[model samples]
Target: MITLAGKKALVLGIANNRSIAWAIAQAFHSAGAELAVNYLPDEKGRFEAKVRELTAPLAPAIFAPCDVRDDAQIAHLFETIASKWGRLDILVHCLAFGNKEDLQGPFTQIRRDGYSLAMEVSAFSLIALANRAVSLMPDGGSILTLTYIGSTRVMEGYGVMGPAKAALEANTRYLAAELGKQNVRVNAVSAGPIRTLAASGLGNIHEAIHKTEAASAIKRAVTQEEVANTALFLASDLASAITGQTIYVDCGFSIMGG
Candidate 1:
């Protein structure tokens, strides 16, 4: 049993109960880790309220608003963590976004702003959060981010998000190397297609899921809970030696040659 007793974990990007971040938070809470969760702020406050409600059962020590695009918000989130828990043991980043327009058309037709937005939110935000998180992890910690097979393979309809994920995986490796001396680990989980609010933005998610089920070794798509379990193992001391790699939870879809 990999336990996170006495650990403090901060999970960002939980939009709702269906989010992979939500699943990871539940798993962490179940394993005895204290939690801090973040939600992206919107003009209407709907996101904040929904996230609060969904995380209510977990009883997170801090549930705050964070827009990764804003440096001050990110700083504030980590500062609050430092003031409250005085340290962090685990950081789970499950955020990614791309314009629906960018995801539908030809990859070459992706708008510059859309491409930049996708890269900033999906890829660079990991570096930004890890930068702030490291200060709160003096004793070392685990930083886990979500990626996808689209990062390496060109999945149709995935569009600019593919390049964004690619950059995220590269960031994972570099951060892992730089943080290793401190015993802090960084890794990415490449999860299979699932029906989540985020995935709903994709034009062909249903088609992708069906294709994945038909071709994958498991003959099915993975659930959020399954991906969350893999995250638990990586976050716990059980995976102390694992770092700088993208662990695929894609039901063996990535291994298929055709």
Candidate 2:
């Protein structure tokens, strides 16, 4: 029902093959969206090379460097898009991070440095990118971000990310409203837990999944591909009228009382 054929999509935050962003990139490619993906360059450049290998099959139109915490890098990234593609149709913001130590300890134990880092990269960067995206999207477009149930509910293991995601969802709504006149749509997909590399740092991530599977009405967790499909819809014309909302793709876990 939804197709993004011919749309230009830029996907940020691909850390590895297991990342939600990578999955979104694959789905976008499958739907015929011309793709460009971002990777943060580490000291050894291993991360970039790994990302390149994982994404080789798609042969993205552009593979650029982007670290959300750096403004100059982000500017260069959009500039590259402008030079190559001239316009952007879909933006997938799948960025998030927090100190692993922050995930295990009590909230009060979270350091100021860690909290600030999480908010800037996970939440504020979306605002920065959206500002850039609007300019390239004179024809209007879709802006999508990845989120989780922890944004609204208390999940002890989610720690600082819970607050960061809360801010991200809030940004989604405000951006959606502000960009409506331009016909730009912004939304977040609050997907259920997946066994991502980042999730592995959560200590008891398996227990969390088990609980989601038992408590959810569907009696199972959602997959990265399923979440990717929902994202594909949001990016396509089918969701033209939808914006400023966090669509739940959690197998009914969010609605359960028990």
* C-alpha lDDT of all candidate models, in order: 0.94, 0.93
Compared with the true structure, what per-residue lDDT tens digits does model 2 show for residues 193-254?
89999889888889999999999999999999999999999999999899999999999999
Candidate 1: C-alpha lDDT: 0.94
Worst 10 residues of 2 by lDDT: 1-10
Model 1: residues with Cα > 4 Å off, grouped in runs: none
Error of 1 at 255 (Å): 0.9
User: Model 2 misses residue 87 by how many Å?
Assistant: 0.4
lDDT of 2: 0.93
Error of 1 at 78 (Å): 0.7
Stretches of candidate 2 off by over 4 Å are none
Task: Give candidate 1's TM-score.
Answer: 0.99
Tens digits of lDDT, candidate 1, 44-163 = 999899999999999999989999999999999999998999999999999899999898788888989999999999999999999999988999999999999988888988888999
Candidate 2 structure, TM-score to reference: 0.98
TM-score of each: 0.99, 0.98
